[model samples]
Every structure is written in structure tokens, then in C-alpha cells.
Target: AQSVTQPDARVTVSEGASLQLRCKYSYSGTPYLFWYVQYPRQGLQLLLKYYSGDPVVQGVNGFEAEFSKSNSSFHLRKASVHWSDSAVYFCVLSGNNYAQGLTFGLGTRVSVFP
Candidate 1:
């Protein structure tokens, strides 16, 4: 089975500042990884995903994520953040195939101060 863990529960940063959210996943075999974000009163949206090939994948709204097998991590990063970026980010792990069930982390709440 695959599992995800987001170390930080909440992160506060000033608007326009660079931000990075940590995500750790545990899975023995190859797994499908994804980063999802949820805004206030909205459903979760896919940010980026890593399946094979490239270790880095670009996402919407200038967001990107890097997958590391050795470290068992898939961290999300944004060079500059906006107040609109404030939301709850989740690290999701689907098993070896996408059809399998998905396991999500507790999620990290990001707040951007203006």
C-alpha cells in the first residue's frame, strides 16, 4: 500500500515570496504521485503529477513539483506566491496503477499575507 505525509500542517508567507511544501510518500513499487490544491469553497484541483520519465513536472498557475525516488518524496514549489494561492495542498499516492485507490495526506494549509 502507498501512503503520504505532509510534515507541515500550516505555512504562512508574505505575498510574492517563494514557497515550498514538503511531501513524503511511502511505497515499495512504482507509484503514481500527484499534488492537489483546494481553494476556499472549491474542490481540489490537480497541480502536478509524476508517473514516469521526467522527474520534474509543471503544473497550473506556475506551480511545479519534483519527484525523488531515493528520498521517497514529491515536493511542491512556487517561485512566487500570490494571495490567491492560499489554500490547502494535498499529496496523493495512487498505487502502481491509476485505477487503484488513492491515499492522501492530512494536507498543508498555506496562507499568504498581503
Candidate 2:
């Protein structure tokens, strides 16, 4: 079984400041890590994914995440955030070939202040 834990329920960042969101996962085989952003009343958009190559994966809107197999963590980071970046971030793990279900974290609501 695959699972994810997002420690923070919410994060507030100032406009033009950097941000990092924490995520941890538990899986047996190779885990497919992903970061998804969801705006109010909108569906989740794929930020990035880590399957085979590179430990550091880049995503849209200057967002990036580092996959650490040792720590079992994949934390999202942004050099500078904008007010428009305010939204809910979710860490997800895709189940292996059988079900391929997505296990999502509770969520972290990011409030960007200007």
C-alpha cells in the first residue's frame, strides 16, 4: 500500500518570498511522487512527477521538488511566490500498476500576502 503524509495543514507566505512545503511517503517499490496545485473550486493540476531520473524535479510556475529516498520525503519549493499562487497544495502517491489509485495528503492551504 502507498501513502503520503503532509505535516502542515496550511502555510502562509508573503508575496515575492520563497516557500517550501513538506511531504513524506511510505511505499514498498519505486514510488511515483507528485505535487498538485488546486485553486478554489478547481481541479488539481499536475505540478511535477518523479519516476526514474533526477532527484530534483521541476514543475510549472517555478515550483520544484526534491525526492529523497533516504528520508522518504519530497518537499516542494518556490524561489518567489505571488499572490496568485495562493491555493491548496497536495502531495500524492500513485499506487502501483494494479489499482493506480492516487493517495492524496490532507492538503496545505497557502495564503500569499501582498
Candidate 3:
């Protein structure tokens, strides 16, 4: 079984500051990892995903994530954040079985202060 863990339940950062959200996964084999963001009263949007190839992948709105197989972690990072970036971010893990569905972390709520 695959599972994800986001140690931080809440994160706060000043506008224009860099940010990193930690994510850890537990899976026996290579698993699909994804970061999704949910805005206030809106559906979740895909921030980035990693399955193979390069460890680093660029996402929308200056977001990016690095996958580390050795550490069993996929952490999301942003060079600089804006106040509008405030939202809830979820770390998800998916195995080969689609029917089993994806396992999601509790989520990290980010608050960007001006």
C-alpha cells in the first residue's frame, strides 16, 4: 500500500519569500507522486507530478517539485511566493492499480502574508 505524509499542517511565509512544503511517501515500488492545490471554495488543481525521468519538474505559477527515490520524498518548492498563492496543498500517491485510487496526505495550508 502507498501512503503520503505532510508533516506540516500549516505554513506561513511573507510575500516574495521562497517556500518549500515537505512530502514523504511509503511504497514498496516506484509510485506516482503529485502535488495539488485547492483554492478557497474551488476544486483542486494539479500543481505538478512525478513518475519517471528528471527528478525536477516545473509546474504552473512558478511551482516546482523534486522527486527523491532514495529518500522516498517529493517536496514542492517555489522560488518566490505571492499573497495569492495562499491555499491548501495536498501530497498524493498513486500505485499501479487505478481501482485502488490515490492516497492523499492531510494537506498543508499555506498563508502568504504581505
What lDDT score goes with residue 105 in model 1?
A: 95
- TM-scores across all candidates? 0.95, 0.96, 0.98
* Model 2 residue 47 distance off true place after TM-score fit, in angstroms: 0.8
**Candidate 1 segments exceeding 4 Å error:** 97-100
Tens digits of lDDT, candidate 3, 1-114: 788999999999999999999999999988999999999999999999998999999999999999999999999999999999999999999998889899999999999999
Model 3 quality (TM-score): 0.98
Candidate 3 segments whose C-alpha is farther than 4 A from its true place: none
Give the residue spans of candidate 2 off by over 4 A.
none
Clashes of each: 0, 0, 0
- RMSD in Å for all candidates: 1.3, 1.0, 0.6
Q: For model 2, what is the C-alpha lDDT against the true structure?
A: 0.93
For this target, which candidate reaches the highest TM-score against the unseen true structure? 3
Query: In candidate 2, which residue pairs clash?
Result: none
In the range 14-100, model 2's lDDT, one tens digit per residue, is 999999999999998888889999999999999999997889999998999999999999999999999999999999998676666
Ordering by lDDT: 3, 1, 2
Q: Write down the RMSD of candidate 2 (Cα, Å).
A: 1.0
For residue 13, give model 1's deviation from the true position in Å. Answer: 0.6
